[model samples]
Target: MEGVLELPPNVVLRAEDLSVVYKMPRGIARVVDRVTIDFRVGRVTAIVGESGSGKTMMASALMKLVPYPGKIEGRILFRSDLLGGVVDILKLSPKELRIIRWREIAMVFQGAQNSFNPTIKIKDHFLDTARAHGLDEKIALEKACKLLELVKLDPERVLESYPHQLSGGMKQRTLIALSLLLDPKVLILDEPTSALDLISQKVLIDLLKDIHERYHMTMIFITHDLPLIAGLAHYVAVMYAFKVVEFGPIDKIIRNPRHPYTVGLLKAIPPLRGELRFVKPIPGSHPDPVNPPPGCRFWPRCPLATDVCRKVEPKMVEVEKDHFVACHRWEEVEVSKLWT
Candidate 1:
């Protein structure tokens, strides 16, 4: 709580110094290190990092949904109109958390498309979700039909079909519709387009853009795809070794990345309209979660690392308006020189 600050008026949700640790037999794995980030109202904030950089864990921590043996430490404040003010989500009881889950903040989890019950029809999934939240079944079905249409799915057909009867793309779209059944103020999606084809991915992205514009809901997208963020996210938080190395407006972060990791990621993205060039993958593998390097977690892999980077961890500092980077020599990071 030392570094926790008051939430800004525009911020719908904020995580301050959040850490998630799993107690394993050999050693404790600190999957999500002290991460602090804000999700602004009516904007999509993408959390981008390598596969095991704890992107999903951090998102799960926001809803207090970390599985057993995994302990969460820190403050997650949700600006709730229903609760009448900002409430620390970590302090809520199980019952209170359940009430807040779908009605206030819903999450379309990673691989949620395959999580449906095989025996039940799609309409029953909606009814069950509504019943759990104490909503009227008849009204919920009516709303579900409307939401299905909004996602460009045929309501009557999808509602009657079972989970296996739909294609992967259709199931994914249905999951999105289900998340919106309660009209949550905030929506968290973890790798929404992970297993979809390129065409399905495009359709989903366009649908998400339309949903954001129409409902004005705060959305948090968790993925490693920089290309997808370019067209969808308004802001981005670049994570490395479970820490946010850079955060700012999507355009600023893409056009002028300050963190060495961020620059490396941007350089790896192939340009759409240009002479084909070699895509240089970032050097070195991700650090071990249980015992990451001292000082800076990224020091072992950072091209711009110095003696200080290996001995003293850098704090997050504002390089420009609303743009923050955590690097000892952020000012000296030359995009072209690091990879060469």
Candidate 2:
């Protein structure tokens, strides 16, 4: 008789062919296409793109935080109790999902200012999460205090402070501390540094990296900053309007990118001081997700796009070792000349 298979503890989170769509007043708008991604224990997977790239939407779907009227599909695999324990997240009821949030999976929100309550103190919120989850309140408060210190905040003062009383970076770190109270297996951070200044952003990024190492927590870092990902991420997923055009190791995708969109994105960044300065922008704005183009979503703006690119959706191809790209004519494109 076939029995249940058991998976090792290291493989924490997995998503296979996940998709999200918003059914608006008129019709359905695709926010995420068939996408497969994984977060191994103790590593950072960075999802990066421009605004409207659907990175945020995809992360939101992973946590089952999307509001009603939004349709999310595909398998989100978490280590389950039976058989290697892989189950479909979409099938779980609200009550079943409660276990996953804050315990198995947690999120560090993008909007630091809006994620908290102005009326409540930080300690009270910590108490709420701890008590609600059946964690001992006194122990939870101590743990929260330790987490605050881990993020380099004043554990004593920050706990007593209100959300409005903290700076942007401070609030961000406090949110991170809250996300870790349960020692979640996976932490999804949506633009964690988008609200801070350059100095504060660097400090917060380092703290996050340190926390990931200390806790062995798998992180899904959602951001629009490629340079930052190049420095921190182990794996990179490049997103366009609701689709991933390329996905690979951070170095491979940055150094010898294949997709036209990916290539353009790399070139668009301003070089560091003392390095050769260059600037270029992706030729076109992202198309509307509600009414996307028939062929490749990036074809309209792709400088190297051809008839096939314009008329047919490009399938993700492994042109090199462990590197995946979705472009009709990767061989014909000249990124060096076009982008230069």
Candidate 3:
């Protein structure tokens, strides 16, 4: 606990070329491949793509939370080499991982509805978490009260109530509070608002933004909703198959997408009043990651794919300063004229 006070606000997480692979019933499946990214000192980075894009898989690799039957590869550097040493998540012992789980890095899951304990009182869960980490019952209760208050929940009622007693929104609020139990430096949220109503979703988004400002913690948001991510993230990384197809500042990636898969994604999202009408949802489904396409995963559905696109894997190429895209014909392919 004494060491917690000295941790500063900076680049708190570095996931270098991480990968998560599962050898399933059929064959080898690469859920996440070569995912190299970071969360900054006090900003939000959103990983946006359609379902099965492997955004969630990449998030799991960072936390070393990928379950059994799956293997994680690559380095997870906590801080820069000078201040904090690099720790390979795959190599860490459970005891060593306990220190990182919630105290240093926390997670807000997409399906909070399924995460709560039915038999345990909600307050007991938070208190128990604190207790497990060496805090006494009384002190844990007090801290739990503070944590719930931050999320705008009634501490007393929630402490005594069971998971079923609370509404869906309330449960998620509780989960958010729990993820911040030890004032974590990094928070990974996977579609935190997917299960809530519109009003509740807005409330949670506002609460998260407020909390992000207050804690100045690095956050990585994973969601399929493009508009939602656009409003929240400073930078966005777009995924197709198990790899990142595009990664750059939000404006650049959103306004002028280079990857064909990314362009197809933008096409799927509806536009507002007078907005350009270029985007048309790319038809057909994503290629199965278990046995992914040899060349481009999106090639089967990509209308612009040429013969070469079907033959060679496209590496992420620098299209602009700070803008990386993985597409073979991005330079010559001009689809900008389609939207008008």
Candidate 4:
């Protein structure tokens, strides 16, 4: 857990006390519960969690993309623009949001291949984005071709092919290229490698690293894959039951996790080549978000839970220098002799 990457105080985007509540027929479901995290400029912060843990909802909520019937309440602050000054995205109107989205803050949505138009060619998709953003046609085409090559694709062949013709990896690369068309300051990628094979995933990881270095834009990676995060992300936030259970520099979380939920997640990953030969899955299923348990959400599944863990909710406590955990038994988790 040594040599953790320390980011400067240059924050590009921040979500403070972000919450999302859905109005369902049965009852209201708190999908995202008071989540707060800062996206450091020119760095990759991966929000890791299991399905239904509200990782995707948190990502979309940052961009004001929460679906209808769901009410989002929070302050999304953007500080990258010096001329325009600090702006709260939550307060922006539709017209104002459109001006910043894609142009200033682009997103490569989850399963981004479905985002393409079936009837149109790849080039036309780029053209559509360019037109909507009010880019010059001739200049846009030139830049689009360059971006396609940057993603390690044959621009000549891909530009003519439809969405269905290209492979999943190809489509994903195209989406990345499209996101870069506007040269946004912050890029949000949701599950960038969910549907890819091992080889494709590796390729995408390398491509993303190259892109990050080339552009120096703030990147937020949202996924459940620990291995992928280990390879690409600089910081990580571990979430469970719509709340962040642990957060810190990636190396510290992976090497010496203090939260029981984070320990379970790390134990679940099978080592490709190491002294550790097996994996241990977490004990129980995630709690229902609509009516979560009163105390710590992980207490129902945690083997180390005590009486207080089941009675009072644990607040985020800084156990290490920069590492934080929201657990009553974090001390026991840290001193456990069995796992070591």
Better of 3 and 4 by TM-score: 4
Candidate 1 has which clashing residue pairs, if any? Answer: none
Ranking by lDDT: 1, 4, 2, 3
Steric clashes per prediction: 0, 0, 2, 0
In model 2, which runs have C-alpha deviations exceeding 4 angstroms? Answer: 1-11, 80-84
Residues 244-272 of candidate 1 have per-residue lDDT tens digits of: 99999998898888999999998887888
All candidates: CA RMSD (Å) = 1.9, 2.5, 4.2, 4.9
> TM per model?
0.97, 0.93, 0.90, 0.94
- Flag clash pairs in model 4: none
Model 3 stretches astray by more than 4 angstroms: 1-10, 80-84, 275-279, 333-335, 338-340
How many backbone clashes can be found in candidate 4?
0
Judged by whole-model lDDT over C-alpha atoms, candidate 1 comes out at 0.91
For model 1 the local lDDT of residue 294 reads 94
Best by lDDT: 1
